[model samples]
Target: MAPAIRVEIEKKHIDEAIERARTGVSKEESYYYGDRLTSGLQLRVQGRQAFWALKYYNFTKTIGYAYPAEDKHLPSVSAARKLAAACKDILDDDPKMLEPMLVKYYGGADRDVKKAKKEMVAVSTGWTVEETAEAMIAARTKPDTDDPIKKSTVAQFRLTLRRPQVKALSKKPIADVTKADLDAVKREMEKSPEGASMIKKFVSDIRSILTWGATHATDMTSLDPSNIWWELVKSGKKKRAITRSPIVDDIVKTLILAESYLERPLPGRFSEGKFGVGHNVLNALWWLALSAQRTTAGTRLRLVDFFPDPKRLGSGWYLAFWAEGETKNGKAFVLPVPPRAAGFLQERMAKAKRNGDSQWCFPSSQARGKIEIDIPVDRNSPGGVTERMAVRDYPTKDKIAKELAKNAKWESPYVDLLAENDIMYWSPHDVRRTIVEVLEEHGIPGGASAVLAHEVRLTDDLLFVDNARNREQYLELRVSRVTKLAYGAGGFIPLKSKAMEVWTNTLIDRYEELHSTYRQARKKAQAERVLKAIYSDANSAAEAKEAAYLELPKIRRKLEDNLTGHKQMLSGLLKKTPPPDAGVRTARIEIELAQADLDAFNTDPASYAIEPSRRAASRTHSAVLQSALKTDEKPVDLVVEAPAYTQLRDQFIADKIDVHTFRLLITERYPITLDMMDDRIITGMVTGDEAL
Candidate 1:
């Protein structure tokens, strides 16, 4: 068939083989050349062609034709030898390089040439951080991919680098990006705990961009942020570079005011009408505080996720909530909400029943009134109005963020109400933090974390029982304690459950005192301003009468003191005859003068009525002034009066009146005059001591 000649291919042999191969071949024959230790190149001959080939270790390739054909496209003997030498050089440089080097030398026939050329171009060109980031974003967000990136992830990446300080570095060449640039980003956000958390994310996003670019676009210089793990010195102490929860009491106070604002919304500036959104926000705040759920988990709650306790007879004493695909850890969790939160949930259910039963508990107004797409329709109708297609929409982190921002907007209708009540602003996460702290302070360390975990276990298997009912009961007991302590609502269990009772009472007391003090301060400020206005306006005669109306109490006290002193002197008048008569006459004359002055003051304003009445036009001012003052007092009473007992009875029946609500009512009734609402009074009104 063919010659089985094995020899080291030399220059002369290649020349002779090429000349013979141009004629034709009977079968395939090969002559190998180069070092045996490193493997060899082959000059193979078959039917009408001879080509150069290689087999070195794992690498095998057919480089090119060895001899010229009709088209004379094949390499000459010397050229083939040069190619073999080039392949040998590439392999000598790197054993892995045979495919790519062969592709480079041979051109169009090889698929790897395109890859090689692209790699060369990438290595040669310098890519800026901005350019590489855009490329990375595009690649991640490509359409019709098996695993598309999350929209939130894309937005986060865009936002992280868009900050003014970090944005400047985007124009820097990737190769020139040093750890210093990363450190600069950290420095900008390191001082603020919230900002520190963002910095960590920003660094993570940047590193991801650099890593992606290293493989896809350019060889990025190593920028591992881990290498720059320097401690953030704050107040000379090494600060823990992470976001921390806010103080528990601050959150509690703010939530109390938030609750009040929800009830009586302030006048609107930006939005008009009722404050349904405020109700949603208030519920979200309580839910997060009681459940210690992440914002996403809580906001994404659906009506279907709730499982009411059979034992509670659907009073929502123990409710289990589980939202799929909406957890920080990415696992579905069955969270047991405490009694207070359950009460809130029960109210929400009633509200939803009245409001068309929206699918989500905190549903977006945008998606609340949608129609299902699967509804049967007349296909042949010439013209018909069809309902908008319904889609399952869950509240996302972005949506919740926008809602919170809207609530806190300066132009928000309710902002003035919060401000007037001395309520401060706080993020939703702060509630979770506050819950954690309250739990820890009252002997449930890591209790809040268990609230967020899929399994409800913390330092014991109380919640890990094999029986579902026992597990639920344990979860309820655990969650109930924390909620009762933080919210000061739900039927109080017992003080014997650790220090929950004392801790809860202390927190509630602190919140009440703070709220009362702020109210008193506001009242004092208002009083001072009113008095100042009265004194300033006393320049006119008619205004002086109004001023006298305000000064009525001081004037009456002075007149009573003078009459009492005059009567005391009558005891000594009986001792002497002339003295008694003289004393009696003197007393009569003094009384007459006082009566005369009082009569003049009560009549029309005279020019010489009294020293203080110099500005009074006439005595008739007193009559009008007294009526105006009484009218003002009536409005004050109307403003400060508690809701009627009928309303209180309705609220109590609805399970809407909490300890805070009761305290607020009492405060409204007496304001700064009362020390505190008596617990006995509250007990009589609310029934069991557990409620207090």
Candidate 2:
């Protein structure tokens, strides 16, 4: 060990020198030096500096230092004495002896240096590096404040004052903190349990402040206060987790029940004054909630975005709105009204029109002019006023969200209603989630990401190809598939079957009418043939009979002419006188010849003079009869006019035939098969001569 040394001071002199030191003299001339001399001991300075000098004797040794500058400069004598006593107590140790003198000298210009040195002594007695580390971690994990920094800053100011907390905390000394000191602070916080959280947060804030100072402060030698705190304290307890709101089925039921309340009548003044505005105000709120839109760049919607009616696009009305502000994305956005939303708008428009509010669909009652009220009424305002209105102002987006929070117990009322009913929700952006879900359920290709408008994850080939063209092709394929399912082959089954039934009945009726007409024509032709045959037979018989009659007349005339010529001969013979028997014999011979000629004409028309003409008429009648008989030949009738064989043959030639009955059979029982037919063929079936 080192040699022992001793020194002492006289009470009066020590006090006088202390007074001088308090008056701001240099430490060499202060009470501490006088104490060494007064002790009547040999003084050997271990260090040359006056403040750091050590006095020693054969018996003892001691270091001496002056009071701190701040304490020395104080006017109070008592305060100076107390500071001197503190300095004297510190002189026993190596660090203690130099620290106070250093603090006295540097404290005015460098208070942190003095404080750090003091804390170093405190940490040596009480804290460890491990404890400091723990405190730092706890600080980092602590909850942040509502306003961590100013809302906004100018560029120049941002550069100068950025991370101010970090700069401030980094300069703090950590060695001074003790574990007991940290525990005491925690105990105090627990004493007021309500403020415990706040205390913990303060500790955390301090730690973060120190960390920032370490990283950003101009001085690098200072201990990080945050690190010191961590070593002094364990991590604070974590906060309990909060539960999210449940999207229960009861919420859906509640909304449905509330829908009727939307249509309830307002308190009416009846014959005295106008109705209470509550009903209208509430109803409009409901409508606005139902019509939630993105109101951002992706889907910017305005008053003009709506079509009045879905069913009648051309006949229905439409609304257009001009937006004033930019969208959330910093880009302009415009949203089109889908069919269903348009229909809803149209119905509302008609109601408003009936109320004589034709000029404005949703007018602002407090607007300065017609142009000001051009947009849809803000839902939160009474009497359709805006937020800036002098009377009833509209609620802001935050206010609206707060109000909705009270009612938003379900996923979304609009989404539930629209999706469940098959009328897709197209307005609110979250409804897109519902849409994508539905598309996925249907197994439509590319539906999942497409509905969400996500970037496509494409193969190399697809990426090289034009995405737009591929998208079009994909859409067309989807359309074709849907069409196939809807139409079920020849045509849409439901409509096509009904149409075919009507067409078959009509064609059958027409066939019956035509058959009746054809039968009549056949009968007429048969009658004409019968008449010609009868006429031929009658003419042949008549011609033979007329020839016999004509033959008799011609024969009689010839006999009479012969008799007249023989009369002259007979007169000459009579004058010459002749026998009576001889005259009678000649007359009998002439009568027999005349009778023979008549018999020959009757036996055969060809034997007489008129026979040739009769034979020619008979031949002509026979030819006419044969020609009419041939013309009247009839085809064999069958039960079925168009046979299966003929139909099959026709089907091959035409690819398919509208076998009236066959089409009906296929439509009802084999609809799927019909769906497989080529689209071109199906189209041809519709335009062809076959029954529909």
C-alpha RMSD for every candidate: 29.2, 44.7
lDDT of 1 by residue, 1-692 (tens): 34335665566766666776777766444333442322456666665666666666677777676566433134544455555566666667765555545544445454343344444312213677887888788887876433347677889888877877687788777766667777776787666657755776776778778777765654444334444332231222344643456565555665565555444423332242354224555555555554556666676665545555444455544544443345665444555454445664567545532234455565443343543321111211100100000001122234435665676432212223333434433455555556656777777664445554554212322222234557567556645433333223322222212223333344444654567664565455444333222222221333443444455556655655665666666556756666767677897677666656555544533222233443342343345334334445422221122224224323432335643574355335322212223321111121111110
Give lDDT tens digits, candidate 2, residues 1-692: 12324334334433443455445544343223333333322222222221223332322332233333233233233333334444444544553344545444344554333353454433133223233333434443455422123222222222222233223222224444335545555555555545455445545544543454354441432555455445345536566443222121222222232333343422221332243233333334323322332323222232323334222247432222222233332321122233333454455544532222313344433444444344334433422311111111223344445655775432211212323333322222333343333344445424323222322121111111224557567544433332333233322233322322332233223333345453465555444443334334333543444444556566557656665555554555456545466775565565566556555545642334333334544565666456546745542111132233223322322324333544444344211123323332112112111221
TM-scores for candidates 1 onward, in order: 0.29, 0.21
The lDDT for every candidate, in the order shown, is 0.49, 0.36
Superposed Cα deviation of residue 564, candidate 2 (Å): 99
Give the C-alpha miss distance for residue 159 in model 2, angstroms: 24
Residue 499 C-alpha lDDT in model 1: 29
lDDT of 1: 0.49
In angstroms, how far off is 496's CA in candidate 2?
Answer: 36
